[model samples]
Target: MGTFTHGATEWDVACPRRPSRVAGLTMAGFRVRDLDPLRMVPHPAVTLLLEFGAGSTVLDCAAGRQERGSIVAGPGLGTGGAVRARGVNVECVQVRLSPVIARAVLGASPADLDGAAVPLGDLWGREASRLREQLGDVPSWQDRFALTEALLARRCAAGPPVDPEVAWAWHRIAVSRGLARVDGLAAEVGWSRKRLWSRFRSQLGLPPKSAVKLVRFDHAAHRLVAGEAAARVAADTGYADQSHLHRDVMAFTGATPVALAAEPFLAVDDLAWPGHGTPGRPHVPAGQRPVRGPESAQPPH
Candidate 1:
């Protein structure tokens, strides 16, 4: 376990020593004593936050909605700068499911989430409660992770997977860092553009174009957080120019690249998901923040 300190935000973050039994799955455990008000950035992955322990996870949305405790949100939950997270003593296991396996593991396509967060209990019923208890009861982070992985593997094995073609398309877009074209995907998959578009949106929660933009933006945002100039980031991440990058950043974050560079959400990435993306993970400045003893597990609410 390590402490992620940036500006005024600090948290205890832990990563699994090994990958999940199931593919296309990644997990991180977090604990925060005082979670600073942090904007929720859009990403191209399904988020399943399993809040446990004594504290809670609270996400306040721009629509006057607030989600507390364990929640499942689809890809791009905070699009257009719509949500912020703030709480004390927050702890949880955060899982980012690749869109390909999200359907099977989540027991529903990401489209069912409708770009909002659903209480885990709403979907898993009693199972969600039981898992919460189990997670809290576990003796160590590794044990909690093992239990979580076993449960996910079981559910994924029993559930129906997305269409293989759809999975392939997602992989191409993800690995290409969102540069893949839908027309090419349709052609390579031997399907009509209409059919591919419909199926992709139905299973992946958003349209193909949106996924591309989100992934591209995620990459660029991380680069910005790493302290790279917006101009350099825009040039490297396929943006038309620095101004285009600035506009997109503002649209998603309601903040400029300079301000975004100081956010805890991306700053924590280097410690939580060091292997986040291909080509190379973002530098994500650790900066000169002070570090101290490791903190115990926490909750998010």
Candidate 2:
């Protein structure tokens, strides 16, 4: 567990690489403290935040839904857009899906990728909040992770099922194995790249390669914020060189690694956990701010 700042808010966080055991599932937990108003909403990712001592308002990007209350489960990027948690004192557990992971689980193709934000409730229906309770009540962290894995397995199977390629690519991206190169991955899966692309578009709404880059950038951003040695993280995450890392960081985060790492308004509690283990994770800047640049800054909205 650690703490970081985002704008005027100070966030306290604790995360486990994997949840404690519970009927053979993996779980992860997230907690946030203090509060900051948000300006811009992030891209697609799943966030599960519970209001224990306070409350806030959240926006749903996909479904165009908005709610203000003590929420237990956040919306999926599909429907759940940007959120502004005001005066928040809460515990959150985010179960995020990279494009690769999403494809793998859904059995869809790269061209099917949409990158739209959907809330978990839109997909999981009523059981969404119940899953959080299951994790919260678990006796041990190990059990918590175990249950989370189980839930993912169940949910992955239950949904309309996206392209398997998206999930596969997402998994590779999450583990830093490159974009899974749609053509190469397609051949491995016994399909032509064109066929895979068609399926990918039909299902997820984003191209396979594009999704891979986003997932990779997302991984890099969190690690950079968490204070990993830039060179080391760059190497491990498949950047061709330090310059490559810097380029992407600057493009996506609008800050040099050193600049981002040093910023007081950075918090990583809401970042994604690629694998089931914890320890060498990174932090993320909190609240919404402009994606700054040396030339000009696009203030977050």
Error of 1 at 104 (Å): 0.7
Per-prediction CA RMSD (Å): 11.4, 12.2
**Candidate 1's residue-wise lDDT over 168-211, tens digit each?**
66766776786777677766555677987999899888888887
The digit string of per-residue lDDT tens for model 2 on 145-251 reads 56666666664555454444433433433344344454565544445678766665555455557555555655565577677898988887778888998887666
Highest-lDDT candidate: 1
Model 2 quality (TM-score): 0.56
Off by over 4 Å in 2: 1-27, 37-54, 57-87, 98-120, 128-153, 157-176, 179-182, 201-205, 226-247, 254-256, 262-301
What is the lDDT of every predicted structure here?
0.79, 0.46
- The CA root-mean-square deviation of candidate 2, after full C-alpha superposition on the true structure, stands at 12.2
Q: How many angstroms is residue 181 displaced in model 1 relative to the true structure, after the best TM-score fit?
A: 2.0
